[model samples]
Target: MTRRPRNSAPEPPAHFAAADLPVRDCVELAAGLASYARRYGLAHVEVSGPPELGELIEEFGLDEVHFVDSHRRPAVDIEATPRTWRCGQRGLRCLSDQLIDAAHAPPGRVATASTLAEGTVLRFTRHNRLGDALGIVTGLEHYCRDNAVASVAVTGSPALAEVVEVFACERVRYAPLSDRAVSGDAIFARSSWSLPWLDRFHHSVSDTYGGRVRHCVTPLLLRQEPERPEREDVVYCQFDARSGTALPLRSARRLLSQVAAHGDVHVLGGPDTQYYLGHDVTYVRAELPEMVARLLSCRLFIGCDSGLGHLAGCLAVPGLIVSTDDFETTWSFFRNYASLSVIPLAAAELLLS
Candidate 1:
């Protein structure tokens, strides 16, 4: 992709007013989006994901949905571990031609070529991890000069979003995927044919956000510390969900049990945490900001290779992230280590001194 050099800040909107936007109930998905765009006076919408998304957006009667392909092409030149997930798909194979074909159809704005100005704010909609989001944004800052950036994420992402602002983002729009008029199709559904989990993430980011640019990995650029309450003797533990890097429940339980024997324990995860961990431990489940606040309130954090561990890292909260062999799969692990302390699952200890 080619971009013009942006040396200075772009001109601001002529009219600006802040208004209270309410979510109104609509019979259909299109009606709700139409109401939202009209109420907000939106000129254009940049959607993150495969191009087929514009077809879904056209149902809303809006013609200005520009698609930013989220599918990523793998780097075949760089040798990687022969993992089950790295299929090494590249080029046109990684793209969604269905969306490319749709772009040429009527309603020119839908799938039309979109342009970005110097101060244009690009908001990323694919936010699932505090560490990944932050790392990719750091790469994005390299390409974006004088441009404002923001992340459109869920309530469970506020803590990381705050850190994103510190890393040069201007705003963090909190609208959970459940609330949006989005089709909720897997962003990787198109690329699943070729790339696996690790490659999909690595290359997609390099393609979409990184733009194949090389930049230095610097210490996290947190400008100011978010005010947190006094720390408590409580230990915060979050080990939920099954993923390529998540620790097994049996191992997580053994570790948390050891930690609980020394002090009061508060678990942070989905409903499953309460069921598996038993009632003896208090489950501290809340939205993102509150979740991070709770993590900050604790003296320590312990979890599997999940986003909460990444959030704990951003707060500089001492903790151990236990992961499987996926830790050695990419160079990103070392890059993230600057902000987070991660240990292999085999070597993680129940007690930290």
Candidate 2:
């Protein structure tokens, strides 16, 4: 049996903050609610799985609610995988697991078209995470185009602005993000999506203090400009991530080296260009603009799960993302799917086919 120090205080179970979440993130939001229950002396989470898995979670006092048995997936397209969990289905699965404790405990704020006014200018007040910003802007871009709505965004990021500049309709404007009153009568909207696991995270902040999740269909608008006909066969790779969520550098280098044997490899961020000096690769000290240019020119982008990969998706750049869990598939995997645990190079090879 596990033991604590004789005079030690009893430690409460670990938890997550589940506020406004995208349907895909319902999985994490579910578990977070469970955590809340345990801490408050409500019901402890009841879980079902193999005995070995049960024992593992018993140690953490959790049910291990995440993508399990992913390694068993046939080394190919995710569609071939039997799990029908993606997007809203993740919400259903989490619900089936009885993760949400209170009945509609957290009031959800979903900004569907019914909630937004037409032809009135709306400005979002919150700005964080290039990835979520990308998803939000992409949704807004399409929303404005389809409905002829005038919308605005408040962000300090020129890189994000560049994305809006490239895709958003003329009716949408990029207002500055900080240190000023929100000009005009601004109705708010927020980007809602799932959490990355462990120390891994990309925020899903709302425009309000705890924002509302806006719903809109985000399209792949990467129809190339004829003037940009000279697209090159370069594969872009990035080993960087926020929240310590990136692949180890040595593993990254090895993967890139293999990808390089097929064609030219462009590394996005790493310690130094000198580190991979001998490899058939070009290491770029990437800025948003530079990254955009490279993304536009390359045949594909490959990287650990990160926001830049989301940026690539925003620009309609095809990407292959290596992630620890299937959470991203529920929201964003950029059309390329690969698994972890079995070492993603094997998964990548299947995605390649």
Candidate 3:
């Protein structure tokens, strides 16, 4: 993605002053909306995850909040029954509820492509890549014009922001992080599709932290672990990249072996290691709280600069993020609560120290 020239003297709006909070999964987006709403005195806010809203409520002291389950409507009828609940299906429902709420809830000035109204809608981008960035901007333009959004705040890549301005919106604001401070105790690392780079980065971090680091992933892996014989010293978790095509499975296997050789290795998402030397690793699938507890208990967090890294940051855990240099310049891990060290692909091995 080409970098757009920074607009040094973009005209500031005179009378623009309403807050539209659209909830998404990204912590930065959530924090941005919360800040916007509090600053502007918004009466109603809509978001995807209820848990995220809980965080907002705690921060902002929400007095008039409504819970809209955009994902799953708890089946009261099935609550008493002993049937297994499909978590992924439930997650889908939560996403659906959020989308529906945004679509039907009063058509506020804030808008997404699917939900827009006349006024200024803050459209947030979902991914870090270029194509998705363009799509988000294009979608926001359509959504703003249809919903009467006078302007749009294009939040995401700098490249996408440039494309959004061409559509003649009222204004665009950038919320880039200027300074970040990572905790010395926490060292974060992860496996990217770039295998050689990930291996080198993993080693660097292990060396730096004296081979003491906690790997964090989603709670899905722990959910599958056996309940009996509860292990406390080293929590087992799995890293599931099954749904996505970009995950470096081969690199992950190699990194896993390196982790095991140095210290106790806990898998947080998946159990497959056939791609790299067929090494067997211990794993446990548990609830999100369990995963969170495990993460908070650790001093240093090492993972790919993905959602797990964000989660650790959200919990105020110090982290060392291993990512592409370009990736750090565009998308950062630190928001309001946590900070990280952005190590480029070339310097990943430095993280092991």
Candidate 4:
């Protein structure tokens, strides 16, 4: 959804910026631009940069951005373009006098430790694994909005973009996740050491809400579509996660058996369909929006430590988020207050009880 301009008056021509920075800097540059645009409600802001930057941000320009190329205005003198700006990341300073003179430089300036009102911007990029980025965005969306904390996500996939647009959540092509971490406020996955983005993000920012994002309830600023009837009475479940994070087949089957007692069960059709083969469960899957809608409409959600579960958290869908035996290390990164290292039925019984 597009934000209306700050005022009805005809807006001034967008301030143009020029940059030939490396891919990482360029992506940060775009995050800065999108962050600024979204914050100020510059409905008509225009942005143009290297071909990579253009391709990276153009689609976002339409919905989740303040930067647009519709003007095709001639480039501003290199000196006049907005410069030294930033949004989500930390410690990478740039000049922003031209970007906004009175407003603090490098937009989204961090608040001193003196107060929690850190008008920080939490950035998410599709490039980051869903487990790494989603909770930070949604958590900030939940706890920090009153402080003007904003979430900005940059993604090429319209589907993923749709997800973050709700939280207001990046990347320039070619930047190592390490470099990208500098632009956002929080990264929860402590294992970012190998991921590098997580390491930089966790180490750089101090406020991560004690790292229990899925535990904090969240709602998209935008209202969900009108509730429609779609098995609003069923118990929804998904025994899936990124590759190895999923539960074992026998455990999954046993879990489904227990869930069957709760009413009709819904599972997204996939390789795991085999888990429900002998059980009486309903297959439920669709486009991202439809999928979310279905989950929202469901009576309850129960799933593994996966994106869908986090998404269910955002929608305030009551559910169980079960983890595998590796819950201490590998699965812990995707955890919340309710996540558990029990068998499917055990996790459900414990949390639901």
Can you list the residue pairs that collide in candidate 2? Answer: 206-211
- Report the Cα lDDT for residue 264, model 1: 90
Residues 195-308 of candidate 4: C-alpha lDDT, one tens digit per residue: 112122333233323322223233344334646676567888787634355766777676677777667877865645645354455676665667767876887777775667
Better of 1 and 3 by TM-score: 1
Error of 2 at 306 (Å): 2.3
- Give the Cα lDDT of each candidate: 0.45, 0.45, 0.37, 0.47
Q: Cα RMSDs of all predictions?
A: 14.6, 13.6, 22.0, 16.6
lDDT (Cα) of model 2: 0.45
lDDT per residue as tens, model 2, 316-348? 676666664453442343442222122254566
Q: lDDT, candidate 3, residue 148?
A: 46
Residue 180 CA displacement from its true place in model 2, Å: 6.8
Ranking according to TM-score, highest score first: 2, 1, 4, 3
TM-score against native, each model: 0.50, 0.52, 0.32, 0.45
Question: Could you arrange the candidates by lDDT from highest to lowest?
Answer: 4, 2, 1, 3
Compared with the true structure, the alpha-carbon lDDT of candidate 1 equals 0.45
**Who wins the TM-score comparison?**
2
lDDT tens readout by residue for model 3, 1-353 = 96656754322111111123233222223333333343334664444443654554443333333334452332111111111111112121232233334334222233213322223323333343322333334333333333444664544456445444332333333344222322111111111211222122232232222322222211111223223333344423233454231235554565556556556767655444233224466654544446566765654555554445545554555655545323432132232223555555345444343
